[model samples]
Target chain A: MVCRVILPRQFRAPELFPQVQREFGRLERIPNHVQFDFSQLQFARPSGVVFLSNLTRYLRRNGCRVTYCGLDPSRDPIAYMDDSLFFEQHCGRRLLDSSQPRPTTRPLMEIRHTEVHGWIGFQLIPWLSASSGVPETELAEFRTCMSELFNNIQDHTEYDVGSVFAQWYPQEHKLEIVVADFGSGIPRTVRTVEAIDSDANAILRSFDEGFSAKSRPTNRGAGLHYLRQNVLDNLGGNLRVHSGSGVVRFEKNGNSHQVKLCEGSGFCPGTMVELEIRTDRIEFDEVNDGSFEW
Target chain B: MVVVVKDLVSSCDTNYDGMVVHKHVLSALHGTDSVVVDFSGIPNVTSSFVNCAFVALLQDFDFAQIRSRLHLQNVNRQIGNLVRDRMKKEAATVA
Candidate 1:
């Protein structure tokens, strides 16, 4: 039973039911169970859990046998396991495990570029998202997470050799992004600017607010910090970072956890960040129109 | 033709004169035997910037027109991907 994925304004606003209705129509003609991948959608302002609860009710009435593919839900199932009730209330019964078959590994996009500076990481994300059918809205946040790291590389390095290698494993159901540059790395960038003895501890603390080596018109070094809160804290994922030979890892699964400075390396000219994201919350959809918004 | 070296390419904010800079660079390549586009002053650029600027110029001026004459100096890795992605997307859409 092949599924027809509808995107953007193919359905109208103020309600997601129209999207369901169209899919049901297609199903009636084809006799195949329908799946709606809302992953590419960008709602003007989501009205919280009530709207989702109502959607569940409407789909049940139609015996649509529906399944949701894309929606960020903005909360992590692993991190927020305590409040399974909370997720059910807002996201309906089709939470984490029930969404789709989780992959042991997935086909990953590998981008090799030596000229884009820190962008290998950032650029890899869109291509991966687009190829994997990760919705643009969720993809935007994923890119933001990588941007925090990419921006750091761009600001801190003058490396002539740059490389970004990433893999999206299906069984792991995660996208692992690794970016490396042969520049000053994190220690030198911090030592020269902040006069602080550089180490993994310093880099860890630097993810906090007011911790930038450079000052811009509107930045507070909050990219890493924000990522910790949203993707790690809110999304139930893992962040592993190694810079200047120091390594620190953060993982959240219904609680915050970390493993620090367990290893060091001589690969100190630049930074390497590996971010693993589960595909359950990923919505692969076209970015052409408002089916999703950035 | 020597395109007046204005500024190197940057991010994809149309409000930031990046679009204008790109247009000027493209316009200078009217019928010149060879055109050199300098990016000495530019630091970084986004995929969208290359799409709206350089890739758009390529779209406007077919490959045969600018292939040999056009040269981008100080090409960064990020901008290269941006151009490549935009061109691929444009080509896919056109075909």
Candidate 2:
């Protein structure tokens, strides 16, 4: 049986997740082939691009033939997604007509599960700095944050692999990074160590300074907390985490931090983290502090 | 004895990258009075690296013993802060 999915018009986090969950459910039930129609997709956030790529990859891995149809180049006109080659690389074809020229320049860096290693910082820092004009000092914080997120995938998730998509929009002065996995969601993982009532509460607890699902010795759960500190608190960025049927968003405004949480309309199989950093507002002084005696 | 962190761990991004070095350091501490983890050549590190390499020691060894027997030397401000922050947070959790 072939499953057909209609892409959402506004593809973004906290909103696009429910649609994705419903579509993913359809894909799960169908065995042979899957077709995704993107004619209705007018706009897509960085997270949406990554989500699509991940979903397509997941479907193909499960012995399903996937195809894309009804993507009108003129109507969609998503420059960032096009520039990033997310559609061509993931869907394995160009969306626009043959006459329309695709962007030759690649705007994003895609990392598969096998390529992640200790030298990832070296690979990411230069690309990020070149794209966003973020100084090496500021990029240092990002390197640490990325390492934590990727490490979580390796340690916490049962999936052997995960994918990360990152792009810096120089015109918009923003950096978008999305990391996703196809393993059990954060709430289910946390439940292995301690009982939790809801996925939303699990997500909230995951951000606590020392909350960890694993046992002692290897259970230092400071990764997400430090990510939140580096991105939202230090760089004044925005963070959204979608896992299972829960979503939590954190944004820094002026000197205050705002957090919002809600239940997803449908269930996401694993976890997706979307972070947006305002490159123009990132200050090195805020990141560079002197040595610590302790 | 002095253990150069850069010489021990080639990269500081992954968890096992740090955990392996932590094991080496733990072995060094078996016979020596103290082991100074020199961070002169290493440029940077993430919390995950530090957690596996240093903070996890809190679970195995007493904090007072770690303070006395394991010394961090030639560390940059960035890594120092990372280690200190993770140590402080883990300490609270363990307490």
For residues A1-294, write the lDDT of model 2, one tens digit per residue: 777878778876555566656656624564578787877777777677777777777778898898877766666545456556766676565554343222222233456655765435566666667767676765667677777777776655677777666656677777777788867778887887878887888888888876887733565678888888889866668988888888888888778877888775666657888888777777665543343366
For model 2, the interface Cα RMSD in angstroms equals 3.2
Q: Could you list the iRMS of every candidate?
A: 13.1, 3.2
Q: What is the C-alpha lDDT profile of model 2 across B1-95, one tens digit per residue?
A: 88888887776776777898888888888869888888776667877688788876886787778878888876655677798877776676687
- lDDT tens digits by residue: candidate 1, A237-268: 78766565466677764564565563333223
Candidate 2: which stretches are off by over 4 Å? A13-15, A21-28, A74-82, A91-110, A117-119, A215-217, A285-292, B30-34, B59-61, B91-95
Q: Candidates' TM-scores?
A: 0.42, 0.85
TM-score of chain A of 2: 0.84
